[model samples]
Target: MTPRGVLGADELNNIAVFKAVSPSVVNITALGLERDFFSLNVQQVPQGTGTGFVWDTQGHVVTNFHVIQGASGARVTLADQSSYKAELVGAFPDRDIAVLKIPAPVAKFKPVTVGTSRDLQVGQKVYAIGNPFGLDQTLTTGIVSALNREIESVTHRTIKGAIQTDAAINPGNSGGPLLDSAGRLIGVNTAIYSPSGASAGIGFAIPVDEVNRIVPRLIRDGRMVRPSLGVTGGGPEINRALGLPKGVALVRVQRNGPAAKAGLKAFSRGDGGILAGDVITAVDGEPVETQDDMLTALERLQPGDSCTLSVWRSGATRKLTVTLAESDD
Candidate 1:
């Protein structure tokens, strides 16, 4: 039996989620300077207003990199209306994530309940807690509109496995938490596929799984550690200009590196004019068409792992087993 003059169970659950997660969400303001166009004067400007959340009790806050980019300073406002000066710790523009530290008491911070995004289903109810258009602590409800969507980062790299939602993400909603029905953090709202710069029911978030893998590394190393192949290759433009086939040709191989140890040669000028060196065609039996593909394939492995590479040399194909080394460059 339903209670008289009371809300339904779904409505009650939504309200409870907003109350539980709003405390963890924060409003960020970035200050900068801009020169006036008409007069030769500089003025202080509010460059950005975005959202973030408490990652832990040690005063670390996580937000999008573009939120604080180019700002001279920033401030964080909490749910209790307490504001504090925030210091930029580190930023990963390739993943669109940044971390900030505030000198606030432990008692004032409430870390959000972290959740996994590995098994999220489409149409599951989700809520976005952000400060859209500078309206602090606003709550919007929607569903997981899609999954495994790819979005481009500020660094021009493709961020795979992005979560697409219809959760009314607006300008000030960047870096805010996208919570599940149970109020657990699943994704960080990053971009929207809207032409009008408003909520067109199409928004994207960085999956918490990638965030889980990268944030700790950022907190410790202050940068992302991506695996490399120890060889310098050219992009597609250079490949086309050289009239080479669709593959990453080694232009330079590091001395005593993995490729050098495996007898991989680099392009050189010899008696027979330009000597074409080894052009990498595949890795671990998977076809690599361009330099980006090679890098993406190498990212799946770590240092000290052995893999077989297929190379095209001297009008023939050859295989070489190379031991991966930690990249210093």
Candidate 2:
């Protein structure tokens, strides 16, 4: 028989999680200068407060891209309300992760433990610890609702493989840690999917795998380099006749783009004179149903990826293998 007042394995675990991670979670407050012509003077505006976690012992802190955005001055407030002035180290607006440098001495820093996002499963219990609305180290709980979400980033680019949760994340939770049941930081809470400008019980986080891929590169190169095919083509049906197969009309190709390098021909006769069009049926064994699918398939590619393209030309099917090139532009 179970004891009358004893706690189970879950309750004790929650308390342990709270104790383990709350200290590493921090509150980031940004202050900005506003120029007011009415007063003919500049005033400091309390920009906002967001959450970030300690990324390393060297005092590098990580948070959302929108957190320290446009920040002219900033500070980090710890659990005890102890504050430290922070400097911008680097930022990745595409991935929504920004690294900040705090001047806090080594003795004052407690690096948070990093966790992998690859192992997360839907319906798993998770928790959020953050300084929502300037409140320090508050805790909220929920479960992983979904995975691998493609969301519009603050930079207007699509960020792939994000974590989705029903965890009540709000305005101040950006850059905070989305922890697993064991108190490990699995995802960095970044955005909320809401129409009312408030938490509708839906939140999104940047997957740690993305952080792992980007953070080091940002630290070294100060930017993320993405490989691209450098070809643009697509329109409604290419205005074909009633019975003919639909095709995408290419207007132009980059001087040395992948398609150009592959020596693929572009239309240039009557109704196609040098008009430069290629009817793409497939790419690297993947069917291209729409423009977005092609873009998405090419999105995560790195340099040196070999791609075979299936094109319909002169009423014939042919395949061409092209080795992708790096785009510095």
TM-score of each predicted structure versus truth: 0.82, 0.79
Query: For this target, which candidate reaches the highest lDDT against the unseen true structure?
Result: 1
For model 1, how does the per-residue alpha-carbon lDDT over 1-329 read when each residue is reduced to its tens digit? 96688888999999999989999999999989889999969876777799999999999899999899889888898888888989888888888999999999999999999999999999999999996444468999999999999899988877878999998998799999999999999999999998899999999999998887777777886766666668998677756766777778888998888899889988777897778788898999988877767876776666778889999886789999998987774
Model 1, C-alpha of 71: deviation from truth (Å): 0.7
Per-residue lDDT for 116 in model 1? 96
lDDT of 2 at 71: 79
**True-structure lDDT of candidate 1:** 0.87
lDDT of each: 0.87, 0.78
Query: lDDT per residue, candidate 2, 111-144, as tens digits?
Result: 7777899989999999988886555578888999
Worst 10 residues of 1 by lDDT: 131-140
* Residue 107 CA displacement from its true place in model 2, Å: 3.2
Instruction: Give the least accurate 10-residue stretch of model 2, judged by summed lDDT.
Output: 239-248
Model 2 stretches astray by more than 4 angstroms? 1-4, 36-43, 133-135, 233-251, 264-329
Pull out the clashing pairs in model 2.
Answer: 268-272, 268-273, 268-274, 269-272, 269-273
- Compute the lDDT of residue 205 as modeled in candidate 2: 91
